[model samples]
Target: MVSIGALARLAGTTTRTIRHYHAVGLLPEPSRLSNGYRDYDAHDAAQLLRVRRLVELGLSLPGVTAALGSHPTPGAGVRDALLALDADLAQQAETIGARRRQLADLLAREDLTTSEQVADLLRDLTTAAPGTGPDQLRRERDLLELLETSGGAEGFTGIADRYRAVLADPAAVDRIGAWAARFEALAGVAAADPVVTEVATELRMLGPELFPGPTGSPAEDGGHGETAWAAFLASLTPAQRRCVELAGQGWPTCAP
Candidate 1:
């Protein structure tokens, strides 16, 4: 005979573990003596140790119980459970190995100015629109980076593809470069200036050249794109910002 504490010590586990096994019915609850202490016999110790060893072998509690319930030795049911667990572990190990290889590739990279998807579009823009000044170029990069990094950028998913198509056409790229240069020319001008509307109009007319989809009423993007737009507008001068706002209210179809 032995106390629960003695059985736990023999099993190389804690008293709490023994109680947990009892609660889960993984092992039979021990009988208590008149003094209120749990009593465990040699048979109880053997069963507890079996449960502990099965758990260490990665058998779930229910599997341990099923294995223990089998006559003489663990049955074919337990064997199948163990095989399933082995296959699951093999898949997990492969996933971990693949993740390690991906991490090694990332570590070997020299530059990560932007993600791969955005990098090509930005490179094409730089090459095709060489007349775009450094400041305008920086603004364009910052805006795209902001959108790309934002979780809410889901609403802007097709932007890169649209830009790619436009930049592929030499005339379209020339028109865009002229449009951006004119937009940058409105730094100190007032918001009510006529060129503000003109620039906004130019942007509207350019919409069909990029995205030829049918025009529809402006639809709300559940405030996600709105937040990004507000942040983008913060960097612009009054006329430039108003022009964009005007273009935004109407062009529901255009964004450079």
Candidate 2:
């Protein structure tokens, strides 16, 4: 008979683990010797070795217990369990790979939040807008930055397509100019007006669709649409501001 400590050493496990296995019914409680110490015979040592091997092969304690038997079928069950674990691991690896690819795309455009495609679209819109100037260009840049950082390449790309369509029409420029004028007039009247606030909120909400971000309140930084718009307006010259102000009039609330 081997002492508990001796069995632990032979089985490459702790005495505590052996006791735990006995408590959990994974291992049978050994007979007590005259010295009040538990004694494990060859059968017990072989059972412990089998348990250790099953654990090393990734079988849970419960799984090992359920599958432990004298028949050759137990080996087949262990093999099947290992195969299932491998399949699960493979799935996790694929998911991790996909996430890494997405992160890589985001990192590559670190300098400009918007993708190249979205930036090109903004450039086209700026060029198409009536009275296009340095200020408008600057505004486009600011908007693109916000969209890129907030929505990501896919979202910015979606907005780019929409804006491109809107800008393609000959009459769209005048309409946009009129809308801008109206928005400026309203902005001048009351920055805190309910109507103005509602419009602003709507515009901000639309921004997320055009530029994706994690589902939450807008970032406290300049990622918010209103904040970006304010920056764009600040960058404009008085003449350019007037042009944008005219474009604001095309909005429904600002329309004549």
Query: What would the per-residue lDDT of candidate 2 be over residues 47-116, giving only the tens digit for each residue?
Result: 9999999888777898777667533775776676668767877898999999788678767764355556
Q: Which window of 10 residues has the lowest lDDT sum in candidate 2?
A: 208-217
Predicted structure with the largest lDDT when compared to the true one: 1
How does candidate 2 fare on TM-score? 0.49
Residue-pair clashes, model 2: 26
Task: Work out the TM-score per prediction.
Answer: 0.57, 0.49
What are the runs in model 2 whose C-alpha is more than 4 Å off? 70-74, 106-160, 163-256
- Please count the clashing residue pairs in each candidate, in the order shown: 0, 26
Per-residue lDDT of 237 in model 1:
92
lDDT by residue (tens digit), candidate 1, 1-256 = 5888888889999999999998988889878899999999988998888788778989888888777676455566667767878998999999999978766665655425555555666777888887779888778776666656543345345666676778889998888888888988999689998989999888777774342221222254444444555677888998988887677664544333
In model 1, which residue pairs have backbone atoms overlapping below 3 Å? none
